[model samples]
Target: MEPSTGKKKTERNWGDKFLNIVEKTGNKLPHPATLFCIFAVAVLLLSAGLAALDVSAEHPDPDIDEKVKVVNLLSKEGIRDILTKAVDNFTGFAPLGVVLVAMLGVGVAERSGLISAFLKKIVMGAPDMLITAVVVFAGIMSSMASDAGYVVLVPLGAVIFLSKGRHPIAGLAAAFAGVSGGFSSNLIITMIDPMLGGFTQESAQMMDSAYTVTPAANLFFMMASTVLITVVGVLVTEKVVEPRLGSYTGSYKQDLDSLKPKENKSLKIALFALIAYVIVVALMTVPETAILRTDEGALLADHESPFIGAMIPLIALSFFIPGLAYGISVGDVKKDKTVVKYMEDTMSTMGGYIVLAFVAAQFVAYFEWSNIGFILAINGAEFLQAINLTGIPLILAFILVSGFINIFVGSASAKWAIMAPVFVPMLMNMGYSPEVAQLAYRIGDSTTNIISPLMPYFAIIVAFAQKYDKNIGIGTLISTMLPYSIAFMIAWMIMLSAWLLLGLPIGPEAPIYY
Candidate 1:
């Protein structure tokens, strides 16, 4: 039975008030790029102020006698250095080229209809009894192709549920939960992995100059999380969300279109091409003397290894080969020019990120060059150490901070650019690996996405939900997704705690402790 009307009303009032506060505060913040610019300027001023005071910290390494001190950035020499290094900083930013290269191939796959058709085939072909689980699983896996799930699978989810004589909103919630709430968990690598890993590596170099973090640093944990999120998402949807949503009583009822013969054939060709490409890559990495292996014959000995360094391009080719194959067979690629045009379209969408990257690069450069990041990290680590908060509790606290910050910052890369220089180095000083810190941040970031108003695609989700139930509002959507967000955070934390206690590697050649 439903809760008493008065009790429900009272609880909703409190939740709505808090969400309103968050929305208003988030709206008051500047655009991310602008925010970075402000931060850069603030860093310059802070550096000058701190330098005047001779603010410094003892190096964390006792063997090092020199203290890391803030450098004044408000002088003529500072301006000259800034002007000279600006372009180099933007160009040298680690995440830039890799994300672009990865997205190029992903764009071809998406534009060729390969990714879209694959999503449809999985969701539409599922048994009636297992449709919810399949939809959620497909949503989690869709990140392998980037943001296409938000555009393709979410609406299709509602349609799939409506056709099954169930509440369409329930299916929308389930799909959204899996896609956004489970965004950090994928069986395969996603663009965010490389992007965030690059940022983490840059931050780690503040303390450990030779340290490197690879895109696969958190792969094993993420793969397990895929199943964890899927199971938890399924349970929440069936037992909590769907039951609460009840049966479909809306005017909208649409049948999901089955995959056409030509698309199905194209998908088969694409899968074959993908499999063939994987085999080729495997051959190049599986043998001791293979071209992609390290000098010592290990395929993935370190980030400097040929296989590890080449992963971004390898991932690109994986998608490019299959996408080209499918597009040709499906007539999407009439000629070579068509493929180039598709790639061009993808680059055009990245104009904003490119702009953001420029300022973000400068901010990171300023923060590092001024020695503020190292000093703060040393002092922060010492403070945490003094409080005896060095292990699981510290990690949990960081996750909570990340999740709270995610509610206001829509872009994961942008947020991480600002946060990693602080948290990654701080955790490193505490004897934790950058991989562990990155994983914790990701867990916090992904779990809050479904309920966060700042997410770019949330409006689209709301519009889709409105098609099924006109009575639905922002409050209703948040209420629906809140369960998924909370459940995902709790379950993910439990898994992370267990993994830490067991001292298992989070990924290939990645240790939990530095």
Candidate 2:
């Protein structure tokens, strides 16, 4: 019998159609490298405009007898100096040096099969309901290892789902949502804590020359955020992602041997090594006599303290030392040469990131030279203050504004460097603490990460998705992840509101108000 028209099978071919559009549009749009160059040019032009108008907060009071001249970017010397200094700073940036150093240990973990083994054990062993939670939890934990979540676990999420007979794209969405969307929320202090803390301190100094912000100021809030984000992430994945995917009958397959029980010897060795490493690190920070502590018997309490400044290096070593030991015991890394090779390999993957960083650094340097960010911030803050808005409304506004800016400029630290100088002090003057302001900025910054194409790693994720289904593209990926993004944003904002109402500290000594 012929099926009725309504019941007849229709070949929608949505995936193919979507890919065609993506390919077409991508061809028309500027190259990613060119896009960055355009951003540099835009910033340069803006700086020139601001300079020509003498629009800056640094100008001397008109009532003062001394006349001050604005530095114009249009001048040959000014343009040359801006470009020269930006290039120099990009080459010599401290964070780039730190990331490169840390990648050495991270590379070994990846190449030695240690990271893969660990992820497989966790994903395969966890119950179905627990998979989402586990992925989110893992995402939170990955911040300790820098960009490992984006680079490693995001693709692994899809592989795990494929092994479980589920839609691999859904798994990718879940992991990407958790890793990038929940980036600011983590159980442990990471390289980002210190980096953002430095910006906060610099901004605070502008208001009160004696003021200093501690790295741990928002630790309490970040710890709470970990739980909040994980729960929200899991719920979104289960309710939104899984349902949308329906019953997966995808052709992707996984090797059952990978899931089979191994000797468990490597697991035990890795476990013991991890425990010992933790104990040693704890000892270093626990006692007043520990060398990592400051004169005041605090770890990472002071801005100039070595412990706070060197935390990234310490974190790198922690991962490397344990991972190295595990590799040697398991015969994955035979000698020191293998370890060095792993380090070099990890660095090789950073070529694109380095280029992005160079362009971003140029934009940042030029913006600073023009003083436009500061001028805008100061004027904006003063306007906000004049309106006498409540603390919550003010912060909420800042979050929205920051989120808008995030779509175009994806670097969190760079965004904060520009926003913090104005927002932090302004909020402080309005009786809010720098920690509160920083937390708000973080929430806004993180929520938009998954949605922004400007984010350096977003394309990497799209490629990861294509590995599972050749037809998948940006639209499909975005649609899959949008639920988590919306859910996370609403839930996180609610959590922040509740925290504010409860007068809970965002971190140790982090307060809602001054």
Candidate 3:
């Protein structure tokens, strides 16, 4: 389903030839849900075979001095375990609840026309000189709201660019690149920061009991990367992607009259509500005696802080209050029942994701139970250690490996859980800090996300693209995004190399050396 951009097939170059192969091969695969089902079954069979051969690894943790064996999921006991745990697996799937809850609030905003109005503000009100950077930076910063970026910004970016008489696909590419490719680069601390930091801490303590990885471990590096990604996004969009895309011929047009006086009033109400909400949140967390602070009088940045755990609900309320305000002002939500209806409608759209989540939950559970990821990580780390590689070259090589593995495993935390226990200690032994190792892993994990089929948001982005160009397919999206992916990897690698040479600290206490 390659898009017919009217370019002759004869003009296709080597990169095009390569991406066509990638897309076609990817398209030949089953749907993500079915693929996860296959992976679950594969994990079961592989576990049984490995258990038969008694394959295992020596657990890396000094406290847990035991060999880790692959658990056989084919046995009667294993079957019973699977049957009983299936429901819990789906319910406990990390992204499932977060996405569903967030969408509930976003649904209200969208239905009440608040979202559209806000997007128009960005599109129409932003200075033309700063629009590209603003869009890219906003996309990067959207990590704070969890998956909201994928749900909102990607589509908005296309709409914004289309309104400006540019290729909408390029806008989509730029936004997707920033949202996913720059996922690890944010000026603010996000849920993933403490989440991955916890993994790094656990792995680090396996080697040194007192070692800890704070939420801010990669803060400085990621802050710098925010700017780097923005610059790269602009460069890739303007210099390569847009020029190749040429003019958009799609029928989608901006509704110039959509923002009525009533809508504008609603928008104003929403904006005021949002400002008030921010003020309240700041007061609750910014002061020494802040209610949102930890028992130790610490702010939201602590690993054990409730604030991070409360992000989903906070995000939901943040959207909900403003959305509710707008809805009331616009008279679209006359009653509480209308808000519930909007929420229901949003859930209705998640049917595909629910199915995918179930299967993916099973796959992830089976992979964990079978101990496959751990064994792979342990053995992979040992192989790298045996080679005795050191310095920036080793870190660069590790980044490439992490990026390659990310194509198959979608979750950043999941991959880091497997890799951290292995690489953190391995790098620590080489006199590199856990923070440095985590930073490198983050770069690899994020840069490859735009190109990975396993990423949960990939299909959603494709659907958004299809809204404009019906002929667009996985191939078209991948081809359009490949440049950004390549550009991010190169730019990030160079930045990391320079940072290392300069002996820069990544965060408050995060140094490059162990």
Candidate 4:
């Protein structure tokens, strides 16, 4: 029999062929925002179906005749309330406010050419084998600054890799793994600390009337997790990603001309100024009587501690001071007008981000107002509890559930807002601590972030890959990263399970139970 014209099979490797199929399909796929709207409709339909069938559950309602009420999406008041809340929620979200404020300083750093110069110096000096490791390390560190890893380090990884005659895509993957995959784990506390802590507190309160989940609840565990992820990320980049890429020999070349060195005198002055700023900041954060600390000596745990609550502003200044010095030295900021321009320019880049955030905020608010998330969470928790699974099996199941949810909804805090209320209380009822539940959620959230299209930066990654291979698409990127995602998932779960069995503290004064 002759082969059909519609389906002529070639002798290509299955992996390569699979990638080809994905690229073709992705090319034909609708735009991401359109896809999101489609999914939102589907969610609406599903909610509608549940309402019609009266399959939804509700918690105690003091004023109502029935404790459990059917979710009515058709109700005009309900829909109006949801839309109103969504709009209000997006505009009022605190993180957006924080980012905007911090960017004023960061903009100055980036514009002064300080950030680029510093990165170039580091890249030039780093060893060959250590290049991938350093990119990953920096990605982990950049988490302290929030979203800078996505905007700065991930693209820089591609640039660095291309410069070194390695596959740029592989470099991007390694950095993405560190930035998004290791999002929850970091050496230093970040804005995420307080965000997650807020969610944890909400979850814990379901069981305890006066419960509190500290911002540093998982600090120790996160510190260790940072080391674990870095080791794994570096190994995977070298062993798996590099070997698969097989000596790039591609036509792409680095634009070293873009990286002009600063004048000697300016460089020297900036270096001194940077040193002075760092010493001052360190002194404020270090001693028992440091100004950044509370009277009791705690840095962030106390409300009165400057270092604790003012970390974001401090971060902004860290970048701004060095950037200002560098800019002044390099004559990039010859006038006060130039300095203000740098700050303004930095804020401009955030325009697209703000739009995305607005949409995401609405979606999150709508989800919360509908009460559908809470209902689903409670039911899901009950089902999991009924399975009677324990230890590794239970933890693994939670990881899988988290990974699955990540594909549809990318926000960690939003997902936790829904999941924590149910899982934390259920687990606590089953003798697991709120810390353990939160840790499990973190593991799941982190491991799958790299591969999920729902992730806000997934599109950015696809764009990065296309710069290397025009034929590349979402599938190509996902396939390349599947190995790292799988490896990290298994390894992270095992690490968490072992930690749980040992009864060790996840962080300082952070216990695994009520």
What C-alpha RMSD separates each model from the true structure? 8.4, 6.9, 3.4, 6.4
Candidate 2 displacement at residue 323 in angstroms: 3.8
List model 1 lDDT by residue over 170-236, tens digit each: 8888889888855689887775787788889988998899999988999999999999999999998
- Give one digit per residue, the lDDT tens place, for model 4 in 1-514: 2211122223246654664565457656654445445545655666667677777554422233443434565478767766666667766755566566667777788778776566566666568678887888888877775665765567668878877667787788889889875576888776567777777777777778687778778888889988888889999888776665655544565644334545445556667877898899889989889988878886655334577567667767877887888888787788999988888887776664576566545555555445566565546555677788876588678878887777656678777876777678777887777877888888888888887765766655665565566555566677667767888898888888788778889987888655
User: What are the clashing pairs of model 3?
Assistant: none
Q: Best lDDT goes to which candidate?
A: 3
Cα lDDT of model 2 by residue, 377-473, tens digit: 4455456566777778888777766766666556678778767866888888888888888888888888888876656576567655656555555
Q: What is the lDDT of candidate 4?
A: 0.70
Clashing pairs in 4: 300-308, 433-512
Give the better candidate number (2 or 4) by lDDT. Answer: 4
Off by over 4 Å in 4: 1-24, 41-49, 58-75, 78-90, 93-107, 145-148, 188-220, 242-254, 257-265, 279-314, 340-361, 409-411, 417-434, 456-477, 500-514
lDDT tens digits, residue span 174-288, model 3: 8888898556899877768878898999999988999988889999998999989999998888877776667776667765445778888889999999999989988887888
Worst 10 residues of 3 by lDDT: 2-11
Output the better candidate (2/4) by TM-score: 4
Backbone clash tally for model 1? 0
What is the lDDT, from 0 to 100, of the residue 211 in candidate 1?
95
Relative to the unseen true structure, what is the C-alpha lDDT of residue 163 in candidate 1, on a scale of 0 to 100?
66
lDDT of each: 0.77, 0.69, 0.81, 0.70
Report the Cα lDDT for residue 52, model 4.
76
- Best prediction by TM-score: 3
